[model samples]
Target chain A: MNKASSALSGLYLLLILFFLYIPIIVMMIMSFNRSELYLLPFEFDLVWYQQLAQNDQLIGAARNSIVIALVNTVIATTLGTLTALCFARYEFRGKRVLQGMLVPTLTMPWLITGTAMLMFFFWSGIGRGLHSILLGHVALSLPYVVIIVGARLRSLGVSMEEAAATLGANGWQTFWRVTAPLMAPGIVAAALFAFAISFDQFVISYFLAPVGTSTLPVQIYSAIRKGFTPEINAISTIIILASMVLMIGFARFSKFGGER
Target chain B: MTSSARRLRAIIGLSGPTALWLTVTVVLPLAAMLVFSFLTVVPVGGREAAFTLKHYTDFFTRPLYLTNAWRSVRLGLEVTFFCALIGYPAAYILAKAIKGRWREALLLLIVLPFWSNSLVRTFSWTMVLSDNGLLARTIHGILPFAPSFDLLYTYPAIVIGLVQSYLPYMILTCYISLQAIEDSLTEAAYSLGASRFDVFRRVILPLSLPGLIAGSVLTFVPVLGAFMEPRILGGQQAIMLGTLIENQFTASFNWPLGAALGFIMLAIVLLIMGLFYPVLKKHISVN
Candidate 1:
């Protein structure tokens, strides 16, 4: 009976993996097709990649995405870390409600937040600009940062800080000297997620962006709207490959330096 | 000494940044939108002026807007159901996979789609389902009389696209909760002569409710506001709340109406959360 069940489990695993990944593999292979139809009468060509490289509009969007993601991520991560520390280390009135409010956005739909931010920025007279756009990303991404960092900090006990205080370390010094280094791994992971989220965000960026400034996802959406060019596929493959490399690199580094 | 008073002061000091951020970024903005939604849309060169409840009333009265909103809600439910259905089994497998070799591989495998951009995923799906595309040709080759299926730009295609995009979240959440269940609980059930199905239904299912709730809500809420997949995959008929709101803001040049619609969405979300939380809470085993 156990053997039969185990075999069934393996089948389930295989099926799920196939469903999840087969589309991606198909897209990657089709990216190089020299055929105009974006389908399987395959002729391999590097033309799409070349087109992708030279498109000024695409390049501008990519630069915009990178700059916005980096700027927003840094701000979100710092604020989120501070917020997480407060939630995890202290007990106070309104704490439970505060925690609940912060935790859900780690999973909240982006659409509402994006729209809300768009309106917020409109009211603030940042109705359209890069700085205003960054505000939306920061708002949406901060929730993720807060949740991850809070969870991480909670897992770390406050005993170390207490001991540091006993040895004459002030609260600020104890936090800096004792807790900050220990919380580095979680912070790094939170930062990475914040950055990834900002990098990949579509709905928020779409709503908040000015007429001229656009991001990569926005560019891709517009390109597909115009027509699903083979060049878009090529660009996508590059983004996927690059992110995978970074994720793996982070995994390796965390294995060593972030063993804490 | 004033040590305890100083400690209380320190905690307040520490909490300052987060409190300030939450107030400005979240609370304040939401308040602004709430006020904006109530404003009247007086045509001022692609915008509105003056305060009026017409947007809200028009939104409630108009078949065009409410129909789209209702459809979006239904689609969100359908998408959530399927994600839970498929994701639960997948998550269950990952949760129970052998610890050393297969587990990490399984976990990473589950997360693969997330690493790929959602637009790319949706586009690839379009490739599969489009006429003369992979799926149709394959079906024609085998069935020979399946009537050249037009899956692209249909409701099913949107659901399929949504499920593919959001299932990973469900799987991840479910896997976390399922993995937390102690082996002994199940072992005891087995030792008591419970059948495998009984063990699952009685012990496992009940225990996994929290994760299931987590997964479903994550899948459902955003999907209700989904714009792109329906547009890209479902085409014209796939108009949901997100798409309609987009039209209001961009194509319609009615920011007040769009903002009203946005606030309506916010209200529905809060209402749904209130109504569902208690019912959902009843299902879980509170620790």
Candidate 2:
């Protein structure tokens, strides 16, 4: 029975990969198709991408997403790195509960968070603005960075920080010169993840965005709801490529794989 | 010595910022929602400053609301079952996969969708399942008897779309747990003449149950409040609790009612997560 089942296992592996990869590859192929309909004929053309570039609403949404994601990434990285260092370097009471922060912040559906944030802002007298969206995003992304960077810290050990203080460099300077550089790769990876999460968030931006301040994801959702076209496919292709490139770049930069 | 102690105190002081962050963002907003759920809704989805349980009473009294809530819960459970069913076997293969440079690439591929925007994934499904979609065209090409595919905005399409998107998460978590189990144990079971099924059932399955619980929580919690897939992918006939909340807020302009519904969904997810919390924290002893 075991020998007979080996053939079945091989088939299962093939099916799983096909299931995972086909949708994405199909989307990529459809993005470039010359047909106006988003369905398949596999015809080749770059016209949709060109159309994507010229569309003002698409362009504006893309621009807004880029600007917002960039700002959110920078702030989340700095504060996340700081917070991770504190968590990793020092042990204190309530650390367990505090560390559980990642579970809710990371796991709760983004739409729920968005609605919650919208209501909170209303009650607190803080009007809807980009800043409010920014605050909400930072709140969400920072916990992820902490977990990623904190893992790196755990491997390195605290001997360096101890050595630095022994050399009379003091805490701040040691962290700035030595620890920061060592942790830079993890920081970069965390930044990539943070930026991607923010860039793609639809609900959080949709609920919290002021009127006329739409992000790309929301813009695309509204567009698709109206109807389907190749332009959205083109935009999606770009996003897919962007994530792949970032993953490759992250792997190249980080020693997370341990120089193998 | 005293100064250093004060400096240590200052470093610990940073926890203040984290707590403040949680209060303003997570706690306060939830508190606001709770308060508003008891208040009155003005016209056009606006909230008035007053206290009343009329919104909850109205929502809970309606059979339609209860039906939608039940639909959402049942669908969530269905998706969770699919994730575990598919995720477990796939995870086993990956855990035993060739351990080299390709491993990260493989793992990254599994996680790739987690990085994509919800809107894009749901919209992608719409394109595939639309009335004139490639799927319908292909079906038409194949057989004359096959019904014309009108899958978009339908229940099956919503499930397929969401399951495809979030299934990666279940696979990855399950893969991690499976890999953490030592191969020696499996080898021992094998030498003892235990069949592959027996080995898996007795040794591997128990070892990875914790991960399964975690994955289910991860999948089901979001699936409960899932708005994007149901709205864009599930046509009008398939309304979910998430969609109901969205309609109340955006269309019906019933903020108080929407708040009540949203909290209801949140409560369900929190309850499930709470039940699974202990399992997630403690490691399962494979031996």
Candidate 3:
């Protein structure tokens, strides 16, 4: 009976995984199909991918997305790492309140946060465009970086830095020589997370994108709303692959879903 | 300089940029949204504006907004219920039934897609659920006499898409909490003559309730504000509070009304979180 139940549980999980992956797999397969109408008896073809390469608007949007995500990664990681260091090393008045500030972006729906950013940016003359989108992306990615790197810092437990100081190294020497090198893997992981967050971000980009220009996601959203084409599937397949690759890198460095 | 003063300076120097960035991008914007919700107009382009409660009042007076608001709540509850139902068992199997390397690999696999582009994943559903899509094609291939059907542009399609999108959150949270349950406690229950069902019901379930609650909140709040999935899958049937607020901003160009609707949704989210705070505090440490 126990063996039967265990097997049933395994089968149940298989079904769930199948459900999770089927739509994504079907989407990828259809991207390679020759038919624009998504008809069956799928003749595998590279026509859609070739067409996607020629699409100037999508190509431009993709360029914009890459640029924004890269910039967002650098800025959010640096600032967030610094803040994580602050939280790790200090016990200050209003520290809890300061940390509480990060909760809104983490917990609140992006719809609310996106619309709020839209209103404020437009009103404050930040105006909608790549700049505003970058700002929003950094804000969204910052908390994740802090949380991930902070966990790493906490695990390091300050002992190494303390030992360095006891050996007559100043704060600068200790941080550069000991702390930074030790924190390298966590920083790399957090930077990858920041990139993925910015790259995969759609809602904020959608709201903040200026007229006639957009990030890849915002562009994809418009295309989906207008109509689906095999070209969309091609771009989506590429996007999913890119995001998964980035996340895999993050998982490797962070030991995500591994032995704690 | 005094040691305390130097420490203060270090804290400011390290944290200032992030604090400033969040203020301009998140804190200030949310504050502006609150102020916008009370305005007579968007207060742009030299348009004279006055404070008014009409937008908030409009939500109460308009049956359409109220009904859609309730629909959004209903959608949240349904999605949360389904996620918990589907995720708990999978989490349990991963946490308890499975062992070692396989458990780690399966957990990673489950979390992988969740980190990928949600927009692309949501769009993927259209291919499988649309009329003459893959599911219909497969069914027809197997049984030529079967009737053709599509699940797209329906409430159930929305539910299905959302459940898939959010299920990993439930699984991850439940798995974390469940893994913390000691094997010895369950062994004790068994040795004390508790049946398998009794042990699960009275022991395992209670121990895992915190994760379940945390996962439910994480799932429910976003589902409450979901727009993209419903738009892609539910078509005209997708007019929940999310889409309604989206229309005010994107189509109607009514910023005030959009802000008001957004706040009402935020209020509901906060109310739910407040209610769950005591339970959440005991089990989850989000940071």
Clashing pairs in 1: B40-B52
Docking class of 2: acceptable
Q: What is the lDDT of residue A214 in candidate 3?
A: 98
DockQ for candidate 2, please give it: 0.44
After superposing candidate 3, which stretches have Cα over 4 Å from the reference?
Answer: A258-260, B279-287
Would you list the rank order by TM-score, best first?
A: 3, 2, 1
Q: What is the alpha-carbon lDDT for the whole of candidate 3?
A: 0.92
1 or 3: which has the higher TM-score? 3
CA shift of B168, model 1, Å: 1.1
Give the higher-lDDT candidate: 1 or 2: 2
Clashing residue pairs, candidate 2?
B45-B253, B153-B234, B153-B235, B154-B235
The candidate scoring highest on TM-score is 3
Worst 10 residues of 3 chain A by lDDT: A93-102
Off by over 4 Å in 2: A1-10, A38-41, A93-97, A100-102, A166-169, A251-260, B12-16, B42-48, B140-145, B282-287
TM-score of each: 0.90, 0.91, 0.98
